[model samples]
Structures are given as structure tokens and as C-alpha cells.
Target chain A: MKLSLSSSPHQRVKRDTGQVMRMVIYAMIPGMIAQSLFFGWGMLIQSVIAVISALVFEGLILYLRNRPIERTLTDYSAVLTGLLIAISIPPTLPWWMTVTGVFFAIAVAKQVYGGLGFNIFNPAMIAYVVLLISFPAAMSLWLPPTTHAGITPSFFDSFSLIFTGFTTSGYDVTQLKTIADGVTMATPLDTLKTGLTQGVTYSESLTKPIFDGGFFEAAGAGWGIVSIAYLLGGLYLWKTRIISWHIPGGMLISVFVCASLLHLVNADYYASPLFHLFNGAVMVGAFFIATDPVSASTTPKGRIIFGAAIGFWIVIIRTFGGYPDAVAFAVIIMNMAVPLIDYYTRPRVYGKNADKGRGKY
Target chain B: MTDFRDLSLQGLWKNNPALVQLLGLCPLLAVTATFINGLGLGLATMLVLIGSNVTVSLVRNLVRNEIRIPVFVMIIAAFVTIIQLIMNAFTYELYLALGIFIPLIVTNCAIIGRAEAFASKNGPLASAYDGLMMGLGFTAVLVILGGMREILGAGTLLAGADRLFGPIAENWTVVLFSTENPFLLAVLPPGAFLGMGLLIAIKNIIDAKIAAQQTVTTEKAARVRVTAES
Candidate 1:
């Protein structure tokens, strides 16, 4: 009788790392498009700069380390890192700063930690944190959406602004900070934070021109569109089995549950759960950063715990911590705990008896 | 010679006060926002180190072993007081800028560590030299790390130079490129940690390269021996 022998119980999966990474890139497209439409061409320019820089830096480091450069480049992890960083940064960030961020993300955050699977923190989030802390002025320089300002920067202008630090017409970024009034618009989250601290009520704070057009109802206009697009992408990821539901579900539930409790206790002091959900980077973080396969927990229960912890930390830090937006810090903090979570929450082996303790037999 | 090299290497890399030994981190992280800040503290620590090491060595045989820690600490505190007064007299601006760190040097582990490990066993001359080398090494790292943070964070170098070197380098601060705002992360405590981590990483890479070269050479020699025997 003829018999064939193969590797034990082997089952090949059709999807590779490249495909998975590419799907994420594809999913980010709608959000990127929304951002461009509302915000301007700066995000697009930054995205391109980030992707190219990430690739080049990744390639250089891999070559220096004697790793297979082509194989590492093909996985698209670096591209994903770049995209996340690009989206997080102010669209008008100078070209060199963007390059510096990408290089740091790839070289220090990813490669220095033994690269890829070995990295303890999310590379993109690290870059965001680095940029946010380092260049607060540039990082906080968010232009009013084109709808509000009636000025949509041309692609060439954005490109020039990024590369040369000036608009095509020779206006520096500082001059372009605000549009109609002396309002001096800050990000919605930042406004809320500063406003609350200055003894302004939540509702009163939302009355600022920055939140005009009934947009803060859905997290202001431009950011709301971007958030919804990210949510759609996240749902697609969940449905397609690209990611499991544990992290997103857990994170969203924790945020809602925590925000609801706080709101109930003091309605005037706290924003609604919906406000917490739709505003800032919570949706993006819930779907994207928390779901990072490498830094996040592996086991089903562990993933839930990890996600919930991040959500909880986000709310706590946002409310009590120094920073207005705490998603990046929260995610990085929880990233450190994944291993312990996975260790304790490991599922039982399929055939092992449930009652059998370590000392039993 | 042996004591000096070992102490210098220990302070510089192997047993770095800030990195490996994790000593005096309060001042290391706090005052390292700029090169002048770090240099000022580093020089202060160096003076204290030399004074304490020499004093500790001189009294090594006189003090009872049981009461030695307190004695060593007292000596360190005394030296720190002297350094503080000198700085307050000459570089009052730097003394003010460094603030609590100058007084806090009395509690720095690197000072007491040398007193315990090297100075307690060696003669005064050797102990003093060891303290000098170790202090210089620590100061060098501080200056380098401070420079990196200042340049990246503020896009300037030798910021606050007047505080350390006097009015000559005052406004000697060249704006490498003016940003609308400085990089806050680099100025914050986290930036200090990250900058220190990168410095350590660079040191590790150099060590790894040297180790790799040694292994290659050893393997080549082994191969040559086998071939000759065959």
C-alpha cells in the first residue's frame, strides 16, 4: 500500500502577513480620504512622506543588522507604522520632523527592541508620543477643517509646506493658525480640558466656534467623519476575521461603562459616553492600536483583559492625568502588561483534565 | 592604575551610575534637560566624589567597620556642602539653576559607592585619582546626554551656557533651527529616560560588535589549527 507522509497535522493558511497588512492599509483609506477632504492635502503629503521614510529606514536598519531586507520590507509592517504615525501627526508638520518621527518609530521603537514581534510597545504610538511631547507647537497646530476656514490647501501647497515649512504664497504655518476670529482654536479634546480647568461648564465650553455647526454632537465635523470612517474600517476588520472582536468590544464597552458612571454621578462635570466614544482618537485606538497583534495579548480572555485595561486607563488618564488625550499613553502602558495577562489567562490544553492540578499526579 | 581604569569604566559604562547602578538618578534625570545643567551637576558630583573618596580612604583604617556607613555619609555630606558653597559664590546662576540637585548630591549613590567599594580599600592618592576618573566619565555621559536632549528638544546646543562657563557662551546658544515650539517630550522626564536608553543602546551595540569580532577571530584561529593538524 502506498502512503504519504507530511508534517504533523499541518494546515496551511491562505492569508500571509503581507495580505493582512495590506488589508489594514486598505481599511485606513476611507479615513485618510475623509481627513483629506475635510482637513486638506497635508495629511496626504505627510502619509506619503512617512511611508517612504519608514521603508527607507526599515531597509537600512535591516541591511545593517544582516537581516533579509526584501522579506522584511514586503511584510508591510513598516508601512503600517508609517501610516498610523502620518494620520496621528499634524498634517502641516515639517518634512524633516515627519522623517525623524518615522525613523524613530522604525529604528528605536521597532528595530532596537529586536524588531517586529519582539517590540514591547506600539511603534506608531511611540512616535506619536515622541512628536507630541517634543514639538508641542507643531503637534498642536491643527488647521480648522476646510469647511470652517473656507481654505483648502492645494496638494502642491501642502507638499511645499511639508518640505519647505512655508505655504506656496510664503505664509508661515504660525500665520495660518486661526481663521475668522481671535478664537485661537485648539483641538476639541484640548479645548474641553483647558475649558473645564478654567471653570467653564462642559456645555458652555462646547459653544466655542471650534465646535460650531452642531458638529460636536458627533465629535465636531472633520474629526467625526474620520472617526466614523475608522469605525467602519474597524467593523470590516472584525467581520473579515482579520481581527477578533474581544479587543474592540472590550475597549468600547469599558469606555462607555466608565463614562456612563462618571456622567451619572455628575452630569455637569463629565462628558457623555457618546462624547467620549466619538471624540478624539478613542475609536481609532480601540480598533487599531489596542488590536496590534504583536503588542496585544494573544489568548481570547487575555485580549479582553488587555483591551479593558487600556480603556479604563484611557478614561482615568484623560480625566485625571496631565494630558487631555490619553489613548497613546494608555495603550503603551497596557502593552507592558500583555505578557502577564497572557500568562495567567492561558486556556487549558484540549485533552487535559480540568480537575488535574499541578500536584495531583 | 588598576583602580583608576576599573572605576572609570564602571562609571562610564559597565556599572554606570545612571544606567546600570541606577544611582543619583534624581539629579541625572532632573538636571539633564540641557548641557549646562548636566555639566554643572556633573562637576559638582566630581568635586564631591574626589573629596569624599580621599577623605574616606584617609579614614579607612581609623573608623570602626560597624560605624563606617555613617562616617562615609557624613564625609560625603560635608564635601557636598563645600561644593555647594563654592558654586553659590562663583556660579550663583548655575547654583540656582541646579537648585536642589547640588544639595541632593550628598545622597547620590555613585559617591557613596566609590567610598565603599574602592576608596575604603585603597590609599588616599589612588582613591582620589579613581574618584576623579570615575567622576569625569560620569560627567562625560551627562554632558553628551544633555546635549542630545537639548538639541533635539529645543533645536539648540549649549543652551544656558552662561550658567556654566560664564557670560562668554551666554547667548552662545545658537538656534540650530527655530521651531514654533520646542519638543516637549525631550524636555519632559520621559525624554530623559528615552535619551538615556538610546545612549545605553549605542554602548551595547559597540560592545556587541567587539564581542562578535573576538568570536570571529577565535573561530578563524581554531579552523586554521584543525587544518594544519590534518
Candidate 2:
């Protein structure tokens, strides 16, 4: 005699945490490569430092918490968190800073909140905000893209600068940021904001040598290629069905709409939609950071609301607020509202019409 | 003896005004930004608690039940106003620093809680004792929170000691580390909430450990009794 167990649905989605985390890690490769290619290979060193510290911290925390260390290590969530933080930070960030950030991300942000799925905020973003707030100068230290900086940090120089704060030839990280005109180049968004604040028009700001690029003009120096790479990775995640399209689609469209409206109203005051979309962390934030399943709105309609609000916040904060780029602030602020969004945007019961969710008769 | 011990224990740990009872959180969180600020506010609160407790207990028998709360509140307000005036006269710097909080201490739930719960029922001596212990307990938490926020936020301990102690204290500030970057987040209001949370978590851990030890000792006693019976 044979016994059989059958169900209506015969297929199952691949629901392994380790596998999903591995996919995310795999997806970030193109973006990381693009960042290295443009910014310098210091991103590579930061990633390595972060990953090592993250694994050690994760393992140590798991040991202290009396959990299975081997099982948790296999999950690769720590690696992914470290990777995200590494990419989000300035590549020339000190090695110790990387260690500190990863420790906060893994031990405080992730493990303290009871690990991966239970974390209330995006662990990477929390550490990013902490570092940005605590060490503003170091956090804003972005190198000019290699094409503009006229001198890229070789692997050894990048290595020495990251670990020892100076290169082989005794050049400092700040020196690496200088161009031929003796000006320490700033990020495109920062340049634009500073210029506009100084009463320069949008076109006048773009004329700065920092904005000189063949294909990267729409984006900042290295940031344009980096953003494109992140967009590609994000699209890959969408294609593989690893992530849903609602978040990035809603975020990008809303950003475009908001920027277009403000730009139309006052061309000199607001940057164009294209500028807002391509510059700084907007591309990466919409596609990668805001789409974290645990912290983001889970409901379909809620996701749209969450994404659109973040987009609106990014634009509002960037144009009028003190900060130049506001992706981290916008994401964290919207994360606090995810619960409210999800509660209101709940899907109706199977037998009930969607009107029930809206409290309509 | 047991009554005083129990009252002291309740004030210090079991029904702690700051940690356990969670009373007077307004001042507990607000003035705890620095050790001196916390210490000053704490002393002021303690003095008011003792004053109100003693006065309320002495007048408890004469007051009507319905009118007692208003009377207790009035007593607390009077003590707070006197303390405010004394602080303004003597520690003028601290008075300015802790401006609204001193007056606001009149509304501190800890003072009225004692007046309503303990002072109204007990003798003046026990009420005074309760007030002292509760005040000390509250002061300890504020100092701890303040010290923690001070150290983490600014990498200093007992900073601004001159504000509370006097001219000699101007040089009493303890420096643990120095940095140019403003650890501004830790000095902000959010730091108060974080510090309070950590303090509460620590209190809970101590509570759980005490409970566990008590259970183990009682089990040992029971086992000894069983063995003796056998």
C-alpha cells in the first residue's frame, strides 16, 4: 500500500534566507564594480574591511546570544549589510570607520533588534545615518571621479590611504580630491546646491569643471556610472522576481513628477527631474535601500505610498532643507510611517470588495 | 524596623520613582543632559518631596477626603515655590539653566503620588523617611542617566560642576576623551530617551536576577526542611 499527500498547489517559491541573501550579494557586484571604476578601488578595500568585521561581529554576537553561529553565518545577511554600507559610504573612509559602522549595523542595528527579518530599520542605512550625523566631514569625503580628478589612487595608494590615512607618495585623502585648478572637488549635488546658494544659476553651476564629463554630465563624475550600475542591478532584481517593481517604479515616477512641477514653477530654483533622478543617492536609494522587505511597506498600495512619500521627501529636503542629498533622511523618515501606511492600505478580505479597507459602504 | 527597611527598599529599587514607578519623567528626561544639571534638579525634587510628604502627613487627619488632593497639591506647590526661590537666590546659574523645570516640579507625579498614597496614611516620621528615600532613589537615577549622557555625548563626566557646587567645582570637570566631531545625537533629546531605555533595561535585568536568586534560596530552604523531616 502506498500513501500520498497532495495539495492544490504543487510548486513552492525558493524561500531560503541564505539563498536570497546570496542573490542580493550577487546583484550588488555590478554597482560595486561601477563605483570602483569611477571613484577608485578604495570601495573594494572598504567592502573587504566591512565584510570581515561584519562576519566577526555577527559571529561574536550569535555566540553571546546562544544561537547557532554556523547557521547564521551561512545566511550571508551580514555580508550584504556590510556591502550595502560600504557602497553607501565614501570609498576613502578610514578602515576603523568601516569597522565601527559595520559593528553598529550588525550588532546594534540588526542583532539588537533580533536579527535580519525582525530589524525595524534598514541596518545599513541606520549605520550610514549614524556615521553621517556623528562625523559629517569624514562622511562627505567623496573623491572626484578618476576622469576629472586627473590622478586616480592606484590600488596600493587606495589601500594605504584607507588603512593609514595617507598614500605611498605621502599624499592625503584630501589631496586625492584635488583637480588641476587646486579646488577640492565636491559631489555634483553639493556643487549645484552651493552654487545656487551663492546666487549662481543652474546653467552656471553646470559650467564648473566638476560637472565636466562626456557621458557622466547628467549624473556626477563617478556617480553617474555608479548610479547606472545600481539601476541595472535593481532591474536585474526585478527581472528575477527577487524584488517587486512597485517601490522603484513609484519612487522614480514621483521624484520625476515632483521635480518637474517645482522646476516648471521656478527653473532657477529647482533642478530638473533628470538632474534629481541621476545625481547623488536617489537611484540607489529608490531601487536598493527603500526596497528592504523588512522595513518597507509590505502591502502593494502601501508600497506605492511609501515610495512616493520618500521621493517627495528627498526632493523637498534637497531643494529647501540644509542637506545636499537627503536619501538617507527620507528613507528613515518614511520607515517610521510604514506601519501607518500598511494599516490603511491593507488588502480586503477574500469575499469583500476593496472598498471595505477604505471604510466605505 | 521592618517598616522602615521595606519603605527604603521600595523607594530605592522595588517602587523606584524613576525606574520602577516611572513618575516625574518630565524632569527625569529633561534635566539629565549633564551630571550637574541632573544633580541640581534631583536635589530640588528631593527637597520638595520631603517637604510635601511631611506637611501632607501632619495635616492628613484634619483634611476632608474629597478636598485632600487639592490640599496635597497646594502643599507641593508651596514647597516647589520655596525651593525655586532658594535656588534662584543661591544657585542662580542652575536656576537659569533648569528654568521651567523647577516650577514644573510642582506637577511631578512622584510628589503627589507619595502625598496621596503613603504620606496621607502614615505618620509624619515614616512619611518623611519615605520622602527621603524616594528622593535619593530618584536622584541616583538622574545622576546615572546624566553622567551617562554626559560621558557619551561629550566624552566628559561631571561637566559643568561649577553650576551646582561652586567656584572650586569649575576645575572639577572630568575629561575622558576629546574629539572635534560633535556627538550631537547623544546630546539631543533622543539621547535622553536612549539613556532612559538603557537604564530601565539594566533595572529589569537586576530585577530578574534578584528574583532568580530568591527562588533558588527558597528552594534550598525547602529541600533542607524535607531532609530534616525524612
Candidate 3:
């Protein structure tokens, strides 16, 4: 009479979806602070726009689907998606474009595929790719880090630029990007790719003002610090067991290996492994985007394969492909292969030898 | 003979080649970037369908069953060639714009599918009617999908109309809005696929609504019957 009649063994993780998402958002704060200090307040403005629009779209879809809007919105998945997209894009992107991206991410990419868990690809990345392909000019308009530019755009200036495509003083993003030499500053990756394409060696390309800290010191001036902050966030995620070590571990190792091999072959042509690790969105992508529990490989061994393949593709695409950054493309490509990866890497049942033939039974 | 009304409904909505049967998607997706391109291709395919259906029906008995596929294909190929020649002579610009697709129409599954399924069994006149209706269904889908893509991709409607019609039709192009930066995704192959998918989804929604209404009416009638009996 005293024995409880529950169906199965009962053990549960105390953290809910909302709690886990909150932790992720907290982890991103360090990186966000770093990004703001270096890239200006445009990122913060973009994040606000994205989050509001994302929440609105999420609410609308939940209402249409006859689901509980408040409870689902509390989970903060849409907020995280909005944050990811906000951080990934050029901060000077117009408000309408940011809203368009958030709409597609929440309404089309997430809800159309039956909401958060059922989505096949990362919604934030899909939105980024869509915006990038649709408006190539706007997508690549990055402001030089404030540390190098010697002028951090005021919050009002960034807000005005995002809304009206110009600051109150009427300086456009293009004009702002112009450095002391009148050469328009670009991202470190963009400068590197352009240099290499124009027949400049890797070392020669690093001599550009964007890599002011020296060739081997860091990826680029502010980029390296922002990447380190993200790495710290990622390590926190790993230590807290919020994300397993397999995906990020495999990704970092493979990126190092691939970049090392190429660097060894021709030091002048290929950048070092540290450069690859700290440059662009590679760190954020490896730790945050690719570690998405829904889209990424689930099996222990499959996660390694998934992460490693993504790293390899990132190097290949960044070096040889048209786009300077390859994180979104690589993640989306690997998302398509998750089903196959899972099928082959299934864990063996207890008392059944995986190497033994099934016919022996 | 099948009722003309029933055949029209089947062709236009119930058993649409592009939306339901999903046949001839190669041409449907490939050439639908502009309205004129779609209209030109649709007309050519319709003509080819009509000719092949009538021809297949006429020779239904002479060709043996075992080799019927080869015979049907030959008839379809001949019609495609005739249409190709006509377009080449009349609409040279549009013809060139469509490029390899006109010849590739011979490989379109919808034409051969109708010939084998409907034409080979029906009389010549009935087969021709079916061919026309089916062709109309396929063409409607192509035009709609093309219009969707063109408007979104380029912000214009009936663009390149002069290539389809004559010089007077040049002004027929309607400018919805002009943008320096066009939505390139809508102009690409992926846009064609997404447009096609949305069209099919819309058709299914309409069909489902009609079915639901019919069920509601039937249920009301049954409830009245039970009330009367009680």
C-alpha cells in the first residue's frame, strides 16, 4: 500500500528549457560586451530590434497554431535565435531588413517546420543566409572595430544609422568605414580573402592595417578578444554540462589540424591555425551555432564527426570559396547529413556485441 | 465518353499535372523566371499535348501493346519538334530565351503520361478534349508560379512581353515597384522550388476547405434525419 505506482524509473534534470536558454543568454553577455566595445552600439540596437520582432512573430504563430503563447515565449528560444542573428549580421543593416530576417527565422524557418525542436536547420543561420544572398551589399557592410578606427559610434548614431541608413550628422556607413588613408576598412577575413585573390601572400595580407596587432599575435585587433570572450562562454557551457564537450572539442581540434597542415605546406600562402581559430565567426559558430541540440548530431560519436566535418568545410570555404566567412554554409550543409550520421553511429544494445554478425543470433 | 465538365474539373484542379501529378517540373521550375517565358513555354507544351494526344488516340489500335511506349514517345517527339519549329520562326527572341528547354520538353513526363493513360484508351475527339483541358491546367500553374517569382524577384509583371506578343505589347510590362537591389533569392532556382511548393500548399488548403464544407452539410442533414425519426 505504501509503494508508489509510477510506470518507469524516475530521474529528471532539474533545469527546464527556459532555464537552459537563460543560461545560454547569460553566457553570451561577455561576448556581447566585447563586441559592443569593439564594433560599437549597433549590435545592441540590432539585438533589440531582432528580439522584439522575433517575439512578435513567435506570438503570432503560436496564436495561429492554437498553442499557449505565454508559456512557449517564456522558453526564450526565439530570443536566443534573435540574439544569434543580431550578433552575426553587420550592425548597420537597416531596421526593416533585420525585421525581415527575424520574420523568416521565426515564422518560416522555425514555426513552418513545426516549431523549435522539429526544425531541421538552425533558424538563425537560415535567416542570415537568406539576408546575405538577397542583399549582398548590406550584408558585408561591417564597421571597423572602434579600437582601430579610433571612434566608437554613439548609441544615438548607431540607432539612427540602423533606422535611417545615416547618422544625425549625415555620415553614411561607407564614409564612416573610410580610414585615415582613405582606404575603406573591411573585416580581417574580407581583407585576407581580397588580398589573396589579388595575389598577395598571407603575411603580406596580414600587414594590412586591420591586423594591427601583428601577424601571429591574434586573429585581428578586437576580433581576437571578442573570440576569446566567446571561447570563455563556450568553456563555461562545456563545464556546466549545458553542452557536451564532443562537438566543440572535435571542431577546435579539426580546425587546428586542417589549418596547420596547410600552413606547413606554404607558410606564406596559408594563415596559421590560431588565425583560423580566432578569426571571423568560427569560434561562435563552433561553440554556439553548431552545438544546437536539435539540428546537430545526437550520438556521442556522430557529434565528433559532425563537428570535425564542419571545421574542415569552414577552412576550405574560407580559403577558396567566394564568401569570406563559411560558418553558416558549413553548419547548414552538415545539418542535412545528421540523419545519415545518426543511422550509422547508433549505440549497441546491452549484451549485444556490435562487431558480431546479426545472423549469429 | 467522359463528361466534358468532369474532365475539365479533373484537369484544372482535381488532378492537376503540375500541382497534383507533379509532372513536367523540369520546365515548370527552369523557365518560369519571367511571365513571358512561362506563357511561351506553356503555349508550346499545350500544343504538343494536344497533337500527341490526338495522334496517340488515332493510332491506338495499329500499335501493339508491348511496343506502345516507343510509339507514344515518337508521336510526342514529333509534336514537340513541330512546336519548336513554329516558335523558332515566329518568336525568335523568346525561343532563344527559353534556350534548351523547348527541345527538352520532349522529356516532360506530363505529355507522355497523358498519352499513355488517357489518349491510348479514349477516342480521338475525347482524347483531344482531355489534352486541351490538361494542358490548360498545367499552363495555369506555370503562369501563376512565374508571376509569383517575377513580381517578387524583379518587382515587375509581364516583363519582356514584347518577346511574346508584338512591339505594341512592350508597354504591357507593369512596374509594381522599382528597387536598386532586387531579391536575388527569388530569381534563383531555389525561388522556383519555394514558389512551386507554396502554390501546391495553397491548392491543397482550398481543396481541404471545400471537403470540410461538404462534410458539414452532410452531417447537418444526418442530424435532421435523426430528429425527424425521433
User: How would you encode candidate 3's per-residue C-alpha lDDT over A129-203 as one tens digit per residue?
Assistant: 889898888899999988677455799999999998888888888888894468778998898888888899999
Displacement of the residue B209 alpha carbon in candidate 3, Å: 0.7
**What docking tier does model 2 reach?**
medium
- Return the top candidate by lDDT: 3
- TM per candidate: 0.90, 0.92, 0.95
Q: By DockQ, is 2 or 3 better?
A: 3
In TM-score terms, candidate 3 sits at: 0.95
What lDDT does candidate 2 reach at residue B12? 91
Query: Of the candidates numbered 1 and 2, which has the greater DockQ value?
Result: 1
Q: Runs in model 2 with CA error above 4 Å?
A: A1-8, A168-180, A214-218, A352-361, B223-230
CAPRI-style docking class of model 3 based on DockQ: high
Winning candidate number (DockQ): 3
Q: Is candidate 1 or candidate 3 better by DockQ?
A: 3
Q: Give candidate 3's total backbone clashes.
A: 0
| Per-residue lDDT value at B57 in model 1 | 96
Order by DockQ, highest first: 3, 1, 2
Off by over 4 Å in 1: A1-12, A174-177, A181-183, A212-218, A350-353, A356-361, B1-22, B167-177, B205-230
Give lDDT tens digits, candidate 1, residues A1-361: 9887798667766899899999988888888888888889999888888999999999999999999999999999999999999988889999888887887799988998999999999999989888777776688788877767645568888888888888888876666665446456677787788889999977887777767763556387577778898999989888888899999999999998998898898877787787788878898899878899999999999989988888898888888877878899999999989889999999989868855665565
The TM-score ranking, best first, is 3, 2, 1
